[model samples]
Target chain A: MRLILRQRELVADAWRYAGEEAGADAPLIATLAELRTDPERHLARRGALGVRLTPVDRVEELATHLPRLALVACEFPGPGEGRGYSQGRLLRERYGFAGELRAVGAGVKQDLVFHLARCGFDALELAPGEDPAAAVRAWQRYEVGYQPGAAQVVLRRQRFFAATPPA
Target chain B: MYQYDELDQALVDARVAEFRDQTRRHLAGELSEEEFRPLRLRNGLYIQRHAPMLRIAIPYGLLSARQLHTLAAVARRYDRGYGHFTTRQNLQLNWPRLEDVPEILAQLATVQMHSIQTSGNCIRNVTADHLAGVAADEVDDPRPYCEIIRQWSSVHPEFTYLPRKFKIAVTGSPADRAASEVHDVGLHLVRDAQGQLGFTVLVGGGLGRMPIIGQVIREFLPVADLLSYLEAILRIYNRQGRRDNIHRARIKVLVKALGIERFRDLVEAEWQENRPHHVQLPQAEVERVRAFFRPQPYEILADLPAPAGNARLQAWYRYNTHAHKVPGYRAVFVSLKAHGEVPGDMSAEQMDALAEIARRYSFGLVRVTHTQNLLLADVRQRDLEALWRELEALRLATPNIGTLTDMIACPGLDFCSLANAGTLDVARQIQQRFDDLDYLYDLGEIEIKMSGCMNACGHHHVGHIGILGVDKHGEEWYQITLGGSASGVTALGEVIGPSVRKNEVAATIERIVEVYRGVRADGERFLDTVRRLGIKPFKEQAYAPHPAAA
Candidate 1:
């Protein structure tokens, strides 16, 4: 049982990632490789389905299976590894993923929580020893952003620089 | 010159508070140095050879007098008594304590300044032409577009942790004073066939171990599509660039490996996909930012005659001043490369004095040039003599701009951890050897750019006479290159011969220049001579055994 920031709340993670022993009743986050190896087998799994993505994994491979997937976990391998950000954006904006999007792996430090959320990750599985409270606080650090992000924090402020287009 | 509105102010303030907490966490041992390095670097804090260096962004090199004063005060209060202006048009405080940076950033924010994305693998400070608004042969000012890009790139979630650092440079004038051709992405402000404003986009140009000139990706990109198009390019580079190796990670390497056509196709596809999702840059916002750069309220005075003065005054007026687009104004260069001083290093006292002088003469504004000089971009022509006297008293009027001694050098082994050798001493050697102004005038516009390593912080690859310091076993050696220019005909310099001893660098330059003097046609600059006669003549003279040794 690990504490995770889900939609800006501290919650116990129920989804088990790769290399973890779990029962068939446990909601499992399978690897993209596993899904690609036996697509029909993994997609037809009982309970809620999820798929884990690495930095090099193509999100388009899971495009057709988005409706069946309930969780998409993008893994960051190490520092300065950013390909997962694009994966998160593609899963949300391009593929219109409706399930939970989680940022997980060694690079998921508290400092990156806001950026991960902005890239549309609703759940952040932060790195080991990172303060969960601080990770949750990072989401509300800035109430504004220059771009129209997927999980943008600002709700009331003017999103665009100009209220209306010039005449 | 753009003023920060409430939203901009709020963002910077929040950033300061966020960094404060990050610093607290690190100091409390909750964050390790390995985890904090990238975090601190993105905020412009670097653990240098001696101490932490905090680089404060002077966006596009424009600074208000108030901001300049605040920088001076910060330098006086926090670290050493001086600061170094980098080649990227940012100021680096060499000796700030890590514990004091958060407060330093707080002090800077009071005057609408921050160090966001100044370093690390993110979009660096967006640079534009130093003479943005006042250059005589100009199109639209590039600063507004630079500001727009700056806002978009600051803390940008997707692109902050790219494969490597990204730089974007914009130039409005056709002269290309900003060296946009050598940047990661270069934007040239241009008018389309229909009189609409747009950009001639160039991609993949960078200076490092493998220097390459950027290729034109778009003939004309409409003004409205700037951000979306840039986002497309960044997304392509981030997802596809080589991340295994640091040396091969720049966008230039990606462009070379994939070829510009394939890269452009990918970027075009990505741009099309992201265009509808992006908040389009509005015409009102463009006008809003452009309004900040409008012409100053100039007096109704006619052009004054050149003042009757001594030879030094005549030379200062000739070399240190540029033509302003307005009738009665001139852009003045405050020479930071004075003889016997480190290039681009300014004292706090000098900063305070210059701020006062700028307030008096240049509409309370100052600009930093890529060549490591401060500029008063809107000085009155009538105030030339008085300004010259004030600058001369402060040793800021060296009257050697665009000369061989007016070199660009980085903080080499003396301060930088990545440097292979020291550059300031070599810069001093060259300055002392070529002390004769008459000979420098005779040489005419030879850019001697020196870098301590191949990281190319000083942009040595594009200099007419490029000097790169090499670590030979334990001693320092110098490699010389010829005929690189960052202007309209942008090209990389070719190495002349094997590296010389560190002491022989100045002599090598002397031999090269003597050869140039002998073979140069009438009115030919050193670069023109090197281009016409080739590096063979200079190489023969430069590597020739010294007469003293013989």
Candidate 2:
């Protein structure tokens, strides 16, 4: 029954996170601790399995289990806490995580939408009181950036041509 | 100087539009103060004591005359009629309103400048040697690399929000004018054994409550791997650094906790594992950026003789001008530390006039030093006299570039909400006490850097004479440190004695100088004397019962 912005579209989330009662038809997103304890047990669940990663959770531990996973949710406790960004990047680029890379927790807001997307978060589950339409509009804040990111095509690639001669 | 391309302009324009929308939302009460604080801070807007302070980035200290004029206009039109040049080679407008910042930023974008990442927990402006291209003892210019780093760090997706604010400095010369060792990351341009250009990378050096010198992480990082190596290091810091406590969150604390060797190993491992995905510096891009820093054309001419002028002019020439690699040119320092005035405050009128003067003499460009002064790096020797006379008329020629009165001070309690004491008045008292130029010349090259708090915004840790302000029971007191030096054996000063009363700070300094004068060896500088004799004599003299007390 929760709503999230997935690939620039606001849609109802069918995945349930930890602490919530697992629905009969909903895919359960378990914590990294749960998945690490008995990977096969979680892997053999009724529906597709997802893993939620805290800031301190190592991405390399989940690499071998990435292919069987349906989603990877990186949690940000607050806005100033930024370890999730590195987690998102490592999951996609280092571990080749092709599943839905989702950003969750209290820190996900409109201000962080562009950065989260740039760091390879294909879906963003913002905190309470955040506007989804404004978060979608945040993607247009920058058409180009200087560094190559997870979705790398938006970077300004051409060599700098000065408008005036150098001194 | 590097000029902005169409792409650069577009990014800046987009940023202005985005900030405008963000500000509108915040004003309409949609965003709470806590939610909007980080967003505004990343754009260099700070809610200071009096008003919002906007810090504009001056990348590698280089500025075109036209850009300077725009800054003057911004100062004149938006806020106060003046701005403060900080120790990081950035300009801060002390009284800008939050509502007006968007419009101010839009105006600044017209001239290819923005205040992006000048504050907050993101990577701040990339700083470098002020005398980048024209210094006599240079390996290579550091500006191009600084620019490359600037672009890579600008709104970096992963590293935008970190444990704490980060600073990086690059220096090319052996003299280390950029103070790279005291930064979060210091990049030194050096040549490998086979004569290939690379960087000697240092990590975790910072000046705050706990000041620590940066440790060398890599002796020689190839030019091609600059961005990748940086990315690896940043990734390690962003992931492993302590975020539980804000005070213990700097990379320095992490480096200290894990030990430099362990930290370096982690960085190296991360770097190796992600080599393919790491951002690599392309040779073509390096060349493209380097082309913008090509040396200005110089005429074939011999060095001229000393100009016949008044004693003030001669003194100005001796103290305020520096040697240039080119024979006929000299790099001139426009002293912002004029006695009895605030250290780095410059009026809009002065900025506009300086822009015109720079256009006439120094190829329409200026450089702001980390010591909070301006420089015309390409002035001809033949033009020194005329330039000095004009500078004298404008009150910019103080003839006290390296003396005791030439201090580095933060805005302190007057403008900073976080300050514990007022530093500008202390600066004025010290200036008034040491009014004699002859006495200042005798005790040559004593750097007095003062900060109103432990934040160390004034870089008091690396000064030869560091003064830190502390509050005790609703009263101001100053703690003095000695023997710190930023260049040629960089060090942090040691505490000399107990805190002195606010009014007695200058007298305490006078006592320390007297001890130096009594005990110094022949031709030794103040720092040399302190290093040789240690702070024992200075401390004894500083704490001895005063005549008035007796």
The C-alpha lDDT values of all candidates are 0.89, 0.89
Model 1 lDDT tens row, A1-167:
88888888889988886677778768989898888888887877787889998898888888888999999999987789999999988787777787999988999887888788878888988888778887777887788777667644543343353212211
Clashing pairs in 1: none
Instruction: Write down the DockQ of candidate 2.
Output: 0.40
In the range B1-550, model 2's lDDT, one tens digit per residue, is 7888877888889889988988998999988888889899999999999899999999988989999999999999997899999999999999988999999999999988999999999898999999899997888999999999998888888999899999999999889999999999999999999999999999999999999999999999999899888988889999888888989989999999999999999999998888658676778989999999999988777998777769998989989999889989999999998887899999999999999999999999999999999999999999999999999988999989989998999999999999998899999999999999999989998999999999999889999999999999989899999998888788999999789998999999999999999988898999999999999989988975968999
- For all predicted structures, in order, the TM-scores are 0.97, 0.97
- What local lDDT does model 1 show for residue A44? 77
- DockQ for each numbered candidate: 0.46, 0.40
Off by over 4 Å in 1: A155-167, B544-549
Fold similarity of candidate 2's chain A to the true chain A, as a TM-score: 0.87
TM-score of chain A, all candidates: 0.89, 0.87
Which stretches in model 2 have alpha-carbon errors above 4 Å?
A18-25, A152-167, B544-549
For model 1, what is the error of residue A98's alpha carbon versus the real structure, in angstroms, after optimal superposition?
A: 1.3
